[model samples]
Target: MTDANTTLPKTNSSPWTSRPFHRQYLMRQANNLFDFFEAPSLNPKGGFFELDDEGKALSAANSTRQVHGTTRMVHSFAIGSLIGRPGSGEMVDHGMDYIWNKHRDAKHGGYVWGLDDNGVTDGTKQAYGHAFVMLAASSAKLVGHPLADKMLADVTEVIERRFWDEKVGAVREEFANDWSQITTYRGQNSNMHLTEALMAAYEATGEKAYLTKAERIAELIIAKHAVPLGHRVAEHFDENWVLDKQYLGSEMFRPSGVTPGHALEWARLLMQLWILGDKRLSWMTDAARNLFRQAIELGWDTQHGGFFYTLDWDNKPIMREKLWWPVAEAIGAAAFLSAYDRDDYFQIWYRKLWDHAENHVIDHARGGWLSELTEDLKPTSRLFTGKPDIYHALQACLIPLYPATGSLTAAIIEAEHTVKQHH
Candidate 1:
């Protein structure tokens, strides 16, 4: 294996921040991915069709059109539209229409989990999915989509009324169809995503309430949950929001043990939260740095070049297969930390992770990315089926290029304004 450290961007230097032309090129490549996933040829019955590994639309038999997937595409395109990419608003409109018309339960109060050609296949109302819907709506609102404001308000209401637990300062996990029964399971994963959505909400609407909710969540997860458990963010939890270290849930979503990807992801979010905190909450910076350090020390596979998907409580790699999103989140975490703190180690990680992605994850021929790779660095798909979604990969490329002071949606808007002013 090539020495990843040797190929890194010069230590202690911020190439992504200093080199404008290269940053433009990289951001364009990321935008091209949004174009690739637009999938104009594929028919959109309710939502945009899922793309295969090669960027073509998956066949109807293979497509279940997850709410999170559809909302992510909408959120991505809404960012594109905010950045002045043509045809992006149209895509955002399509996704918005689908979510409101098809994915939302007319009978129940929240969005369904998944839909197919026939109709809603999985009808469970998940906080995770609803969080994405809020994110999508927040971004859409920013770009002035006709339905975005109303959708944002509606989903925000649903989240507050149905999912949020103000008493616990976090959200409940899921509910049965018709919102008839709620589960005893509490999860950090959903709340992490909720924190992300709330940040966007606060950015879009200038609502301090959203920021308040987000801060509570970060305090619970990063300060309360992860710090007590050696900085490894626990994925599963009990009804009391107590850590459930031995709970073996679904392989894809609710697996046992700590997911390093999530820790790195939360690290990034915490930094963003800190940045949005207007320089108060000095502990946020410390906590963010600690999470990044913990994830790198525990999640990184030193023998190979990428991050492990899951880690046992002992910080040992549980799932050895290297999924693409973890590396993407790692890159974002490194980029944000490097930019904010100017740490040489983070700069090294920023370069090393991009090198790893260039060598293994990015699909040069196919145009998007390889979702899964074996420990030997060969492409594999034991976990993810295809280029399922673009949220993590897109952020990995774009966040490093922007100032870490605001949300990406707001950063791109400011960037566009700056470019106009320079001209």
Candidate 2:
């Protein structure tokens, strides 16, 4: 086995922790990721780029604009701008224009699901997309975009009136075009993203309401759902918020069984929530640690070094193919847990996960990252083709640079401002 202290920043035999050297290392990796995606990911018309297998821009004519994709680009570049990356604001503006002009439903209140050259390909109003819009707007607000606050308000109002279920602590799943017909299905996937967006919104606006809503959702996922289910979050639910274990709604979004990626992600988010809020939530800390532990134990491929995409209820690998996002989430989870727990296992996992990313996931030639790879680590496009967005990978690379309290963008922004003041 490798000596864990060899990778530690300064200490000869201590586990890795956040020091100046560690910060510099993380910054370098983050910049490498940011620089690669900043230019290539942008579409010439406006919004972000989606490339073909050859690393060329996917033809605009055939390309359809997805609400989540565009919003993710906006959020990613806005983070870049927060960290003083040049031209990132322009990219943010590009995505904002697309959000306002193409994605927004003029007749209806909320954003549409997809758009193409003909416009409005999939007109469904989804909480998943709206959550990302909130995230994008929150990041833009931090960067002082002209339309950010207005956009944030518009989305916030729509989410409150349409998506937020007062009786239930989480957002609803999907709605019809006029926002009249709501689905019977409830989903933790959308709510998970909603929890993430609410945290960002709280940080951007200091609205206690947003934080309160976030905490409720976190409790639903972490306490009600995951903690009782052996740390496996139930992805689908009925109208009454009952678990739908047999549900197989959407192949990508609502697949049956548990997604280890979301489990690891919630673990990371739970810690951030604990730190951001009262910091007295001992249950939150325990839940976070347990979730991380269970996820690593169940989702990690014992034969291979990467995480399985999905695990059956029996803890068997349902989807054997490894994707980039789970490892990215695992990296973020390990980074924060290592800092919080000072556990040597997390430190070991941190090093191992980064090594796996550097060796297998990173697209050194194409710029961004390979979205998926086979179990043997060969490149595969079955799940995702080319690089889509930088949100997960960027956060994984940057979040380790700061203490585990706030949004990655906000933390980086504050750290930069502190350094400038000191200088």
Candidate 3:
């Protein structure tokens, strides 16, 4: 392992960005991830299964299927199909079938949160999960899946009628299965992800409404809320859009105080939003830089060689355990910043972050990345069970291979068009 105090050798030119060798390395990593999850994740009875460390399903039957997990599988495999990976279309089809048949609430308007072989487990409809539903549908649509358009349109209506708050320019947090409000709580995490899905929807369908809503969300969350807090995004908010500094929900999902991982994610999302809008959002570039800088300065542990999970208002580390997703998000944010600004600073951080991931987070012996590590970079599972997600880690590998112009799907489509024209 590389020493924590040592710096990687610097070069005048970026050693990895846009280079063919690096692209091949990234492609291999992406393929290894697909190999790890593709077979084990397929639960024949309904939706997907959660995988263990050795890439085996935790439960063969009657396992809980969360909406986010189901949707993420669809989105990831759709990318695989677009990239010409064999057997990927089958996985996408399986996930799409399960999402439509099982996860969708036929009795209620929107999708349910969790399901098992028997029936619904948690019927609460959440904006966070629904955002992923839209994302899955959009990615499937990009790959021309049969049910993509139907699912996309259905989720769009549900979001508009139930979640979207026109008065505040963001979506409400949660609701019961019967379409009743579950809480007056509002959250930036949901809105940030919604911004991501809305962009994917626009790329898939070319609908101005989707793009318009995405812009509204960026303005409300990043420009209005985060800018004042020194680019540290507050997680919880009240019904009237007031900040809730004391709010604590799920340790894995909603931890108290500021989450630097989220700020890194928003940095990447804001950059994509700026690109999709033809660089019309001039302020977003600066905001993206600031967010990235804040996350690195406050969240990254210089001696421990990883990002802390959470920080207090004073920017001190609250959750000292380092997690994989934050490192993944930082790699992505670094890639975007490196491409946008053409700066060696972002490039240096990009290499450093990848080095940390390859050394600590990635299970070189196993097929997937470890979810959690102690501050000293030892693997631990206190916060996450076996490797249940590939969304963040996969993107961290693949996003750097594509141009920083738009979302991954959009970049894939553009690449395909470019190749065909040359042929």
The TM-scores, one per candidate, come to 0.95, 0.94, 0.97
TM-score of model number 2 = 0.94
lDDT of 1: 0.83
Error of 3 at 88 (Å): 0.7
How does residue 13 of candidate 3 score in lDDT? 65
What's the TM for model 1?
0.95
Off by over 4 Å in 1: 1-14, 40-42, 420-423
- 120 in model 2: Cα distance from truth in Å? 0.7
- Candidate number achieving the greatest lDDT relative to the actual structure: 3
* Candidate 2, superposed: residue stretches over 4 Å from native: 1-25
Worst-scoring 10-residue span by lDDT in model 1: 1-10
Higher-scoring candidate on TM-score, 1 or 3? 3
Runs of candidate 3 exceeding 4 Å displacement: 1-12
Please report how far candidate 2 places residue 378 from its true position, in Å. Answer: 1.3
Q: Candidate 2, residue 403: CA error in Å?
A: 2.4
